[model samples]
Target chain A: MSYALSTLWFERQRYLPAVLAVAFSCLLIALQCGLLLGLFSITSIPIDESSADIWVAHPDVPSVDLGIPIPEAWQSYLAVPEIAHTEPYIEGFAYWKKPTGGTELVLIIGARLGPDSIGAIRQLTPELRMLLSETSSAVIDEGEFTRLGIEKVGDTAEILGKRVRIVGTVSGLRSLAGPYLFCSLDTARKFLNPPPGQCTFILGKCHDKEDAPKVVERLKAHPRKLYPFTTQDFSFHSQMHWLTKTKAGIALGLAAALGLLVGAVVTSQTLYSATVASLKEYAVLRALGIPRWRMAMMVVSQAFWVGIAGIAFAIPTIFGIAFVGAEVGAKIMLPYWLLIFATSITLVMAMLSGLFALRSLRMVEPVTLLR
Target chain B: MRADGLPLTPSMKAWGLTRSYGSGDTKTYALRNVSLEIYPGQIALLMGPSGSGKSTLLAVLSGLLHPDAGTVLTLDKDLWAMNERQREAFRLEHFGFIFQGYNLFPALTAREQLEMILKWGTGCSARDATARTSDVLTMLGMSKKAHLRPMQLSGGEKQRVAIGRALIKQPNFVFADEPTAALDWKQGQHVIELLRAAAHDQGSTILVVAHDARIIPFVDRVLHLEDGILYEGEERPMELYGGPTAPSPGYIAQ
Candidate 1:
């Protein structure tokens, strides 16, 4: 080991608090960044789960929420040379009457009972799909059974003043707003009372996924009151709609950034104080004729070791938090891109704090050793 | 006294060394019009009471501190004429220092302490430095305790290790600030004798600053400082048992 490294070992007590501070900062940073990424991921789920390439919605509808339902005749879009097929889906929000007679808020969605239907419900097994073809049949996520007071698949509930029966349960479908209750288009139209022969979205399959841009352009040129978006384009716009127009999205994003900012400040202050305390040792080296750069390398070495150790500690901690979040139907997803980004941010923060700590080293004069 | 022995060539010389802290009426002078010459192959003692600028003079002469208005020369190279980088290189090439409290690195074992100095002062590889460290430690009577850290060693052992650090590079000169202050009489005398032998054997100039007169019977020349100025008293070499056993290594007859 270099003298720089050995010095840290000798002074471990003097440097322990700073090391832990950086570790805690890493945890908070990963937590916030991971949460933001997960939020963005789930926002795209409605788009990602779809097999269709083209989505038609209200010209200004940025998110999944429906605008005034449009006429269902948009199926004529399939007749376009670039288009293959189309399906209409209904989406809205309503109150769910619990068994206790109290109402809870819910997002309600409806689509045709076919594999080619417009919604992204993974729970619609062949059996469930046949069952959902019957009116008054619906499905709810299995994870929320306790929260909703439902004991089994045959449990009944009331949505929008219409009696509904849960026929099946699905996994991996969750929303931050509340639980989702999926039913048929006919049932949705009869209960929520949207205009007859109308749907909030028109999903279109393209002959070739690559040709979607051309299809969207052609559909746009033909005079129709609807907007055309590739599934990706629609997903992005939907997420942006929520992010730009709603306070919840903006607040969560700010909170994530705030966590990173606060972590850096706390860790930087702690490391800076530790560097100040070691100035005397640094001065002794300087007086002994060690170069100023060598002394700086000493401080940088300490910071580097601290950063590595902090990251080691933060990985398991963040994984535990994510696991706990999953149990409550809240997902704290950490995709590979987020992991790489967080790791880079961690090293930069550590190096920046190291540089900040160097500010105190400049004050260490060789003359201090004389005293 | 000089007729008996005075160097025709000196290792270091300073003229009008003046240093002060603060400014305006509140300013206090640590050194004023101080001038002196240091000779080779001899341990010289500097004595003074508190706040008399004994340590300040040592700092200025050794290139550890810059005087407000003065000039210092070692081996005829102007210590202040060079920039900070050059001054640093000059100190590494020419000077070694032992502080009163032993100022040894608390983390480094006894051998590693000397190895740190040897490697940095000479640009040698760690293996080579470690090799030399064992030889240097043995020379200082510290071979058995080379692996112990400063805190694990006693006061005298620490002082001897400090002396070993000063001697490792065979520097052009060594400045020790109160080398014997922390030791008892026997340890103090032993440390002084070690420094004396190193000076006699290596021909390196050694200057020690202290207030303890108990160390006086062991040095070659004694100088007194009172209020930032040297007393310029008569120069006399201390009587010794059979005199300096070995001729100074780099000495030329005057």
Candidate 2:
């Protein structure tokens, strides 16, 4: 065993605080970022739940939910060998007159209810699609009924003074800002009423999912100045828009920084005191003419080991907590890249703390060991 | 070669040495124009009262503390003339130190305690260090306890491990400051006997700083320090202690 590792093992009781502090920092950073990512993920639900491989939107569409009208004729722009099919998608926010005598803002999403359509969300079963085919019929998330001021799937509401009946409800499709009303294209047009022959976006399906980026690239040169994105790109763009608009990333950054600061301080102090406790033994080595760098290396090596140990403890706990969060309806996204990022930053913080603790080695004076 | 018919020569010679502490009205001298020579294959005991210049002299001679004036010429090099790095390198090559306390790392076993010196200081390979550490532990009668840490060993065993650390390099000079201060008389006597063997068997120059008068009979010569002044006591014959009879070296009168 290495001297540093042996020493750390023997004195693990003394170093526990540092290990725990590092673990806490890793946990806090990962969980907070995961929760924020999950929150922003909701903003891209329209793009994520669709079968479309590519989306063609207005030139300045920042997010799927915030899209502006584009001429439905632009669907022909996606006419390429890589594209298997195309359909017009209409979406806009409208105020619904609740039967309980109040008005609530709700997003109206309209798509072709055909089985071969690329714009309809996958949650719309054949029965629900057939029910939605009737004019002025809509489906919503079961959890949003309270927010929409409705009692059940058969309840009726008014959008723009036009009566609309809820056909059915789906699970796990809740929205962030407004309740989503999924309906047929004619029903949504009756409510949102974009200018004739215009839609919010034109979605395309590719023969091969990997060809979506190529198709999007080809559409980028269209004279109409269209915005084109693969489904994954569109999802990411939508989430990024909401993230920056809400300034939630800055809050996450501050929270993670605070965790790192606390971890650094505690870890630095722990290493400092441990080094000081061994000063006499180090002084003896110094008197025997061992170079100061050797001792410094040992301290830094201890810090490195502490970081590895802390990260080992944290990864499982992060996953476990994420699992619990999912069970309780709190979405926490622990993507592989996020895990790597959290651990990498945490390891760097620990190494910096090790450098900070090196100041204690200066107190080792060989002459003090005599007499 | 000397008038005493002894083939003696000094390996380390320090002259006109002076060291002081503090300054102004609070200034006090620890070594005042003191000089000494320690010969190879000889165990020289330096006895001094509290506040004497014993440890200061040891530090200066071992290249650990610098003297305010004068020079220490050891192994034919001016010890004080070398830069800090050079001095440290000089110590690593030729000097060994045993402070008053054991000062062994509590986490390492006895064998590891000695191997660390060769591995870290001399950069000796692991196999060589392990072999040398085994030999030293055997010599110290500590081979059986080589795997024990400081907490697991008795005080005397721990001190023996410390002594092994000092001798593991086979340094030309070994300077011990009150190595027996924390041991009982029997353990202290055993400690001095080990130092004697290093000087007599290994032909290393040994200088021990202690206040115990009981250690006088175990060493070949005794030197006393008082008020920063150094004094040489009468030397004894090597045959009396069954040690190798090296030529007698004369001391400079203080």
Q: DockQ winner among the candidates?
A: 2
Interface RMSD of 1: 2.2
Q: Name the runs in model 2 displaced over 4 angstroms.
A: A210-226, B1-7, B234-254
Which residue pairs does candidate 2 place in steric collision? Answer: none
For candidate 1, lDDT tens digit of each residue in A94-209?
77788766877777778777877756565578788888778887777887666566788988878767788888887776665657767788877766778877888888877788
Local accuracy of candidate 1 as per-residue lDDT tens digits, B20-75: 88899998787767777878888888887788788888888878778998788789
Best prediction by TM-score:
2
Predicted complex 1: DockQ: 0.38
Task: Estimate candidate 2's alpha-carbon lDDT, on a 0 to 1 scale.
Answer: 0.89
| Interface RMSD, prediction 2 | 0.9
lDDT of 2 by residue, B117-220 (tens): 99999999999999999999999999999999999998899899999999999999999999998999999999999999999999999999998889999998
User: What local distance difference test score does each model get?
Assistant: 0.74, 0.89
Question: Cα RMSD for candidate 2?
Answer: 5.0
Query: TM-score, each model?
Result: 0.74, 0.91
